[model samples]
Target: MNINGDYHVHTAFCPHGSNDKIEAYIEQAITKGLTELSFTEHAPLPKSFSDPTPDKDSAMKWADLDQYIQTIEKVKKDYQSQLKINLGFELDYIEGYESAITSFLNDYGSVIDDSILSVHMLKTNMDDYVCVDFSVEEFARIIQLFGSVEAVYDRYYQTLEKAIVADLGPYKPNRIGHLTLIHKYQRKYAVDQGYQFTIERLLDIMKKNKLELDVNTAGLYKEECLELYPPQAIVDLASQKGIPLKPGSDSHTAKTIARGFNKLSLLTNN
Candidate 1:
């Protein structure tokens, strides 16, 4: 047995979730006979929607996250016989969002065992979009000015570079979530073929900084990649550097947990 561990599990603390109470999920994992259970709730963000003029509501759901942690602590004792539970959070990054990322991270980082840096929507104009690192108006303005297909790619890749390189913390990351899944949306060029332009730099950056990425297999569930990010070449390079590895399904639902991890493991082990 692989000692089945699920580290990317989320809970109702995120706006995108419901009924994901850590205790309930932990119990479910025990039912499934899981060996190790971890809860990595979404990282906290600032209140952009509470500007009063535009009461769009916050991008993420509101909850007593600290209390949620305390609740997990309370429940852990009950599940001690079935599974070992750990705590973590999935952090998002934007250039300006650094302060919020840093603030919340500093407050909570020490308390948790690990954190992951995931760049969600690539900051769009929609205030509701998790990708609010940059203004959507700016993305449109560039499109209108340049009007070249390559220009859009240039901007997107540049933005991604910033996100990947952003100053995170004392620990680089336990595992990287969907590395290039962003291409499923905005990528103009074939990600694998054209990724060199992006990877050539990011590879060196991750290597120099000693960062390792994940082999996220959830893409099989979403029908995106044959698997998820960092492509084969990147995986090879990371292996060469002796960078660490973490296999994840990025499971949102209990059913999606480690869904395609078997095939994903074979691909990355090369």
Candidate 2:
């Protein structure tokens, strides 16, 4: 696969990611023969939302927002001749925080070159939530709260569907990230339900909305999920519908850029 760009990448700004410099990531992309890369660092959560994970490092600090952009701007100027660098954020789509998200986009969206809307935190109750892929213990707790592996999967798809159709102003990200992130630990808590109908519904809505699919490769490295997000079968279905499938490494470290490019059969076929 002649991969040209990686649309979803984290940076030193991410609290949960490595402290590798932004320049290092750009150098890695250039070394891997990628012409373009987007630093989709996790945006700060809404003020009303509380961090549920143990360490509470799922996203970046609000105080660092400006510096994050400025740092990127500096690196972008330096690497302009060598690579096409994009400034972006991986915004979370918490179900009840639409207004906050909209306000945020309105304030900063003008400068963003590319971005992604993703669902990392799942609401289990009116106020309580859980970070879906935080840890295996957390996944177990999520199953206990939702009552089963099936219910958790159902809620994830349902939330993703809502995210696809929700109105978050003009700055809303065009890419729907990691469509099957809930399967990150499927080997341990595998469910019997196929969720074919729900998956198809999501694809249909994505097609209608003209949203891009982030065919994330991070799941392939997860010990439990030895396949692509949405897997190949679902990838084929998206291809049949003519949805744009862009590969993303979801790399937390600079060395991980284009980590699984060869596994992208859709890119190869094209």
Cα lDDT listed for each candidate: 0.58, 0.90
RMSD of 2: 1.5
Q: Top TM-score: which candidate number?
A: 2
lDDT of 1: 0.58
Clashes of each: 4, 0
lDDT string for model 2 (198-227, tens) is 888899999999988888889999999888
What residue runs in model 2 are displaced by over 4 Å at the alpha carbon? 266-270
Scored by Cα lDDT, where does model 2 land?
0.90
- TM-score for each candidate, following the candidate numbering: 0.74, 0.97
User: Model 1, range 127-169, lDDT digits (tens) per residue?
Assistant: 3233321334433454454454355555556665676677756
Those runs of model 1 whose alpha carbons end farther than 4 Å from true positions after fitting are: 1-3, 27-34, 48-62, 123-153, 169-174, 186-193, 224-226, 266-270
lDDT at position 233, candidate 1: 61
TM-score of model 2 vs. true structure = 0.97
Worst 10 residues of 2 by lDDT: 261-270
